[model samples]
Target: MKHQATPYFTFNGNAGEALDYYKQIFHGEVINLQTFGEADFETPEEMDQRVMHAQFKKDALFFMVSDSFTDQNVKTGSNIALVLECESTDEIQTYYDRLKNDGNVLMELQDTFWGATYAKVKDPYGITWDLNYTKEQ
Candidate 1:
């Protein structure tokens, strides 16, 4: 299966500003910008304006950014993660199994409201990973 890695940045609560800053600096298009309030998922009232997810794309350079959930805190050293987009369910499972072998499972691999099989894990070396496989319609 084809696998692609994208850098994901997590901010405490200034994801929108970060996204805007990156767009301005890179002259890239910020697409798929969604706020916690915009999504159908449940969130605290205070998190309504927080960025749930957003992407910045300029030519071949692409990455994602989002605000941490209300219950979580984002610190500088642990704010970045690698998003592995897999091509199939098995592919995701395979990688998840390998990565979580001696790692911590931040989020168990499961189906998400956004129509994808997703999970988050921190490898033994402390590098976080976001594994996802979007099912076909």
Candidate 2:
């Protein structure tokens, strides 16, 4: 199974601005910018304009970013999460089982509107992980 770990940054409500700033600084382009309002699932009215997800790419360098949806604001030290792009369902399940053993399951593994199996977990070490496995279409 293939595994790619990418840095995912979370902003309180300024993810769009942050993405734009990064794009300018790194001379990258923001690809696939999807806002909460654009998602197939329902979102809070306040989150309608917030970024649900976006990718910044400059050649080989890439990262993901989104605005937080929780009641808590994004803290300085806890705004980053590691995203693991799994190649298969088995791969994601195995990782999820292992990671959640001594960790907190922030979001359980389940099919998403984006056509992928996704989950979020915070390990004992306090590092958050976002695991996603998209089926080939």
Candidate 3:
């Protein structure tokens, strides 16, 4: 029953600076930093040098940050978006299939290497969504 979307920002190779500045301005806590050079990135030459993801938290607020991949002509202003976490596989799969009708899917819905059901799609509205549903134990 969680409706909150985790906002993921995409910087143009300035994610570290952006996250740091925001942390200072909001007095936030910068948590994990996942760079693109890690094993998750296939084309590290294009993404390895960039920040894959970073977490910033303060008070009741929390968000993530990263850089837009240079391999694609990603829009600067509208590069990032909400990551929706569905409660169930059926819910997420159904939502993903429905959302991808006219949508550009970045990744097909499948079990990720991290052991989670994951998919990404950019809706016609130009908003990128990372839809994730953790496998129920």
lDDT of each: 0.91, 0.93, 0.82
Clashing residue pairs for model 1: none
Q: Which stretches of candidate 1 lie over 4 Å from their true place?
A: 1-3
Better of 1 and 3 by lDDT: 1
Model 3 lDDT tens row, 4-35? 99998888888888987997899888897878
Give the TM-score of each candidate. Answer: 0.94, 0.96, 0.84
Look at candidate 3 and tell me the lDDT of residue 51.
85
Per-residue lDDT of candidate 2, residues 1-137 (tens digit): 45468999999999999987897899999999999999998799989999999999999998999999877878998999999999899999999999999999999999999999999999999999999999898
Q: Report model 2's TM-score to 2 decimal places.
A: 0.96
Point out where model 2 deviates above 4 Å. Answer: 1-3
lDDT of model 1, residue 14: 94
Per-residue alpha-carbon lDDT of model 1 for 1-137, expressed as tens digits? 45468999999999998888888999999999999998887888999999999999999999999999957778898999999889999889999999889999999999998999999999999999999899998
